[model samples]
Target: MASIELKNVIKRYGKGKTANQVIHGVNAHIADGEFIVIVGPSGCGKSTLLRMVAGLEEITEGDICIGGRVVNQLEPAERDIAMVFQNYALYPHMSVFDNMAYGLKIAKVPVDDIKSRVDKAAKILELGPYLQRKPRELSGGQRQRVAMGRAIVRQPQVFLFDEPLSNLDAKLRAQTRLEIQKLHRELGITSLFVTHDQVEAMTLAQRMIVMNGGVMEQFGTPEEVYTRPATTFVASFIGSPPMNLLKDAPDAKPGVITGIRPEHLDITPSGWALQVEAVEMLGAERLVYGRWAHSATDQLVIIRTEEAHAVPVLGTTIHVTPRADRLHAFDAATGKRMMTA
Candidate 1:
């Protein structure tokens, strides 16, 4: 296992006046054997940054070090890293055993050693029974495991995953997530996974790098990112329904934004009156969507409540109160969180 470091990393396309910069000075210190997920919306440079770390893309500036050695000029094969792509890039005609053993064979490892490594990886991934089956003969989840098994046999210093679970069904994705977590616990390899899904990032990452428009929004534990976001973008992007930003709220200074999560707002006898616009039933809980009553602006608000609670009728006004301790204050002009007085 190895620790990875990124110092002032940047990526740019073209050159000179027409150059378009993508990644903007990303910096992080990934501990040995730590699993970090790079998460953001599409076109946010998450994949680009992962590719840069894997030596698949050139770094425009700064240093990338693996196991304390700088690798800015190293080729992909020389970086001693294994990558599992979104698509299972398995050869159609090769059996699972051959697929897993291909890298060892290319490196001219001893025949016996190759067999041992392939067998161990197959057992770990539960693909021992499908060793003889071709890629076409296996299910999507099985094929994905085969791809992972191939990576495990290499025993690389770091593992890079580029949205590896995006292709799987929801149930399979959840199951595979658990499997990946178990694999990490057992092998304890340093891994960096890139995904556009916040739920996956929150569940699978020991820590996460949240990106937006090539800039590093925040890098922290899931709890910290969700509980105390560094900026308005992080506040709105990390949650499911997202944090609500009330502009020009009552008793608030002009140009200040107040952020509160859906679950933190509760129906009360007296508070901000919400005019219900819509309701959505989601299993054990319901989502109430509405606007603050008597306000000229149409800023929307969402409240989450248990299904057992009485559902408020559409068009009816109900009072909702935000938990004071849970509220976040930000500077609307800069979209940055404000320090409380």
Candidate 2:
């Protein structure tokens, strides 16, 4: 395991007046053996950042260090980091054992050592029974496992995952997430995972970095990012149904935009009055869609409640309010959080 650090990293394409900057001096520290997830919407530079760390992309300026050594000039193979891609880049004709052993063999590792390493990784990944099976014979999840096992067998200083579960179905994604968590626990390698899915980032990361338009918006534990979002962008991006951010009354000066998560808003008899527009039953939870009666715009709010059986009927006079300390306020123009305002 090794600590990875990015010091004022910047990336740009082309030059002069036409130069397009994709990363704007990003700085982050990934501690030894820690799992860090980089999350954001598409085109936010999360994947670009990860690619830079893996030496697939060149850094325009600043340093990338792994195990306290600057690796700005090192080739990817020399960087000693193993990466698992989103598409599970496995060899179709190679058996699972060969796929896992390929890297070691390429490095001229002894045949006996390659066998030992492959066997160990297969056992850890529960792929022992599929050693002789080719990639075409394996299921999607199994192919993913083989990809991870290939990375594991290398024993690299860092493990980098680039949306490795994006190709899986919802059920398989959940199951594979557990497997990944277990694999991380057992291997204890410093890992950096990049994904656009907020749920995946929240569930898999020890700490997460939220990026927007090539800048770091927030970096914190999942709870911190979810509960006390540093910016309105994060507030609206990190949740399932997402947090409702409504513009405050225009007459109120320095009036902040108020945010409330779906789960935080509850139905009350005597609360902020709203007109229930629709109700969606999601088996375990009900999504109450409505608009404040006083609002002039058509901004809708979503309320997720566990009481599906007792959900308010549509077209009824409904009252909804947030739990104490659940309200989030943001600057109307800047989109920055106004927690103290």
Candidate 3:
């Protein structure tokens, strides 16, 4: 395993006045053996950043170092990294064992050594039974495992995953996620995963980089990013029901917005009066959407509570209180978090 560093990385297309800059200056230091997930919505440059690290894309500026070596001039093959892509680019006619061993064979590795490596990877991925089967005969989940197995046999210093689980169904995705976690524990290779799914980033990352509009919005552990979002975009984007940003919240300053997560609000006899707009039952939890009774605009506030809690009647005004300690403040214009005094 080796540490990877990105120093003020930037990416741009075209030249001169026609240049369309995508990735802004991004700086991050990922520790050795760390599993880092780069997450954001589509077109956020998360994949572009990963491609740069893998040497698949030329860096327009700044430096990318892997294992303390400057790899800007290095080709993808020389970067000592194995990548697993969203599409399982498997050889349909080749059996699983042969597909996994093809790279080693091309490198002129000994037949016995190749067999040993392929066997070890197959065992780890629980694909020993499917080794002789062709890619067309395997299930989607099994195919993905084969792709991962192919990478494992190489035993590279780093592993790059570009939405590797995107093709699976929800159940398969969950199952594959656990398998990936187990795989990481067993082979401890430094990994960088790029995904648009926040659930993947939250569950798999040792640290996560949240990107937006080609900029690195924030980089930190899952808890840090969730509890203390650095900006309003993160606050709204990371959660399921998302945080409520109230422009006309009680005592909120003219240039500021009050942010509150749905779970942080409580039904009370007296507090901010809100008119219940709608209520949704979601398994064990109930989500209550309400509009501020006093605010002129129609922005809605949501409250998440256990199903046992009484659901407020629609169109009826109810009092709800926000936990003082749980409230987040942000500058309205800049959309940046405002630190409490």
Candidate 4:
């Protein structure tokens, strides 16, 4: 295992006046054996940053250090990192054992060592019984495990995963996520995973880097990012229904935006009047969509309630109150959270 650091990293295309910068000055220190997820929407440069660390992309500025050694000029193979791609790039003709052992074989490792490593990895991944099975015969989750098994056999200092679970179905993705957490606990390998899914980031990451439009929005634990977002972007992007940013909220300062989550708003007998527009039943909870009563604008508000909670009829006026401590305040102009004195 190794620690990774990126100091003032930047990436750009072209040069001089025409240069288009993709990644801004991104700085992060990943501890040894830490599982970090680089999460953001598409085109946010999460993958680009991951590739830069993996040596697949060049850093325009700053230094990248792995295990305390600067590796800006080293090739990907020389970085002692293993990458598991989204496609689960396995050889269809090769058996699971052969696919897992191919890298060792190419590196001229002894046959006995290769066998031992492959066996251990297979046992760890529960692929021992399927060692002789071809890629085509395996299920999607099995194939993904094989991809992971291949990486485990290398015993690299760092593991890079580029949306490895995107191809799996919802159930398989959830199962694989648990499997990955178990694997990390057992091996304690330093891993960096990239994904656009916030749920995956929240579930799998010990610490996550939230990016937006090539900028590092926030880098913190999931709970910190969720509970005390640094900016309006982080506040809105990290939640399920997303935090609601109410412009020109009553009793607020002129330049402040009041933010509240759906679950933080409770239906009350007297508060801000809301007219229910729609309701969605989601198993154990209900989502009530509405707009503020007597307001000229049509900005929508959402409230979450338990399934047994009574809901007003559509078009009926109801009052909702935001939990005071749960409220977030952001500067309307800058979209950054405002500190309370």
Give the TM-scores of the predictions, in the order they appear.
Answer: 0.98, 0.96, 0.98, 0.98
| Candidate 2 C-alpha error for residue 80, in Å | 0.9
Of candidates 2 and 1, the better by TM-score: 1
Clashes of each: 0, 0, 0, 0
Poorest 10 consecutive residues by lDDT, candidate 4: 290-299
Q: Give the whole-model CA lDDT for all candidates, comma-separated.
A: 0.94, 0.90, 0.94, 0.93
Kindly give the stretch of ten consecutive residues in candidate 3 with the minimal lDDT sum.
291-300
How do the residues 228-256 of candidate 4 rate in per-residue lDDT, one tens digit apiece? Answer: 89889999889999988888667888888
The segments of candidate 4 whose C-alpha lies over 4 angstroms from its true place after superposition are: none
Residue 233, candidate 1: alpha-carbon lDDT:
91
In model 2, the runs with Cα more than 4 Å from the true position are: 249-253
> What does candidate 1 score in Cα RMSD to the true structure?
1.0
Candidate 2 lDDT tens digits, 1-341: 89999999999999989999999999998899999999999999999999999999999999999999999999999999999999888988899999999989999999998999999999988999999999999999999999999999899999999999999999999999999999999999999999999999999999999999999999999999998999889998999888988885333345678888889888887777777899888888889898776876667888898954487878887877777678778888898987732
Off by more than 4 A, model 1: none
- Could you give candidate 3's per-residue lDDT for residues 44-132 as a string of tens digits? 99999999999888899999999999999999999999999999999999999999999999999999999999999999999999999
What TM-score, to 2 decimals, does candidate 4 have?
0.98
Candidate 3 residue pairs in backbone clash? none
